[model samples]
Target: MSILVFVEQRDARVRSIVREVLGEASRLAAVLGGPVVGVCPAASDPGLATLGDAGAERVLLAAHEAFARYDAAGYTLAVVAAIEAVKPQVVLFGASAMGRDLAPRVAARLGVGLATDCTALAADGGRLTATRPVFAGKAIQKLAFPRVPALASLRPKVFAPAAASGRTATVEPLTVGFDPAAARAKVVRMAAAAGARVDLTEADVIVSGGRGLQDAGNFRLIEELAEALGAAVGASRAVVDAGWRPHSEQVGQTGKTVSPKLYVAVGISGAIQHLAGMSSSRCIVAINKDPEAPIFKVADYGVVGRFEEVVPALIEAVKQLNAQV
Candidate 1:
């Protein structure tokens, strides 16, 4: 048996989540005594080195000029072709925007069942079991795969990157025949978000604000706190829908799921959808005027107060600590 992992890259750089996914694949492969193969679709991506370091026995690069921009249909087709060629028993993806968009497409093309956004995966008795949160994270569901290639998209940060054992794998080119322009969805005009901070998925510490921010201007306080702690700034779905922040900054079931080491939720009553995205954080701090808010149930610490009063004091405390350091 062999495991094939799709290496997710951006800006010609391998995202940290890809390394984590590779580590996860390596562990799964070890348990099943399977070889691990990494796949990257790019014309010239230097991040291939990191994949080799992550314990991939072979890294396959699918070079095409059309891959410069992400096309969901084109990428899915390329992945399907790669899987056919490699004939891996299992496949994995980093449950990011691209993975979320591409995984189902590949599964459908291959006429297989795929477990989406899996928090944990294990193979036993020649079957793959995928564990994922369901019902707004109120329950975790473990399901078995009944397909030729067990397909799963792993949530970012759920698996830690294993140690590099000083082995570099051979890089190979994938032979895929497809037309990029023939894809259904064409990503047009992608504008970068302003003042990019640490990636939310990769951040160890995250300071997130909610509807309690009131307006977009109040987000400056959150940004200030994030900067002081060297953390990423995240928002609840309410704030993102209100246009106070970009969709990328939103953390909820309908948005990006994150599991930072420390999560600070301000002025946001924890909804089930919101908790589904961040309940996996190592430590949670909830600051809300209503002490009975559902967020407190999952939070490690709680502060009952208004954001207008609490945020300034928190900022000052962070600043004082920084100055002392």
Candidate 2:
């Protein structure tokens, strides 16, 4: 009858999305009158003591050698085992690459319904409802679970992380055994992006550029502005299609969705696909030469001018502001 959160970690460090999921879960658990529990799969202890401050009363560690890297079959078996042992009424996962891949597999194994990419979650009268954008972000849909052990994946950066409570969670080891041959795929190695900045989905601020930049070489302007603001760099589908940026940095209906605290669109005309990904940002700033640009419709602030002239001024302004702070 507890809320179970899947704790995601990289290099023994917990992902920020886990804290976001845990924060929302804690709110739901308060209404459901249940405790919050964390389920983690790792080769060794990932230093999860801080989860208690994030609302986890207890942590379940499913230790296994295969868990060092993500193995679909191995992870599915491990998560299923944890669910079986705890029998939580609700289960939550971060809507990250790994979570998106693993949630469906776990749901299928349990034959339960799952809601993905939910931006809002609420509990009323002990019933949980999830809200997600649908129809290419043109509409919103609310979903309710008809069965126990309701499962859902939450979008990153949409919910604020829980404030520290100065509490420590009790860690317990969960025993799991799976056949090595059951894993059809194995991660041979991982290559980190060199000099990578904040992940787009997890960033608080984002600066995005589009085809209006005229050429791929102009992306350095976007990067420089992003650096000045300590933000992640994003690109529209057109830019990505032109091979100016990697698909990983693309923001659109076919790309990764984001809900950062601040979004700056430089030379972007505001395609619906691009809007679908970042419309949830708390603040939006659009800079374009044409006042009729579609992006201005949703922007909290708009500047009409060529980015070459406008961006440099904005970057200097930001630098001045940072220096004062």
Give per-candidate clash totals: 0, 0
TM-score between model 2 and native:
0.96
Per-residue error at 105 for model 1, in Å? Answer: 1.4
The parts of candidate 1 lying over 4 Å away from their true place are 181-184, 193-195, 198-202, 213-216, 237-248, 323-325
Compose the digit string of candidate 2's lDDT tens values, residues 1-325: 8999999876666788899999998888888978899989888888888899998999899888878777778778778888998899899999988899999999999999899989999887788899998865768999999987999999888887788888999999988787766666888777885225588988889999999999999988899999999999999999999999999999879887788899999999998989988898899999999999999999999999999999999999999999999
Q: How high is the lDDT of residue 80 in model 2?
A: 89
lDDT of each candidate versus the true structure = 0.84, 0.89
Candidate 1 collision pairs: none
* TM-score to true structure, per model: 0.89, 0.96
lDDT digits (tens) for residues 10-85 of candidate 1: 6666677788888888898888777889888876765575566787888888877777666777677679888988
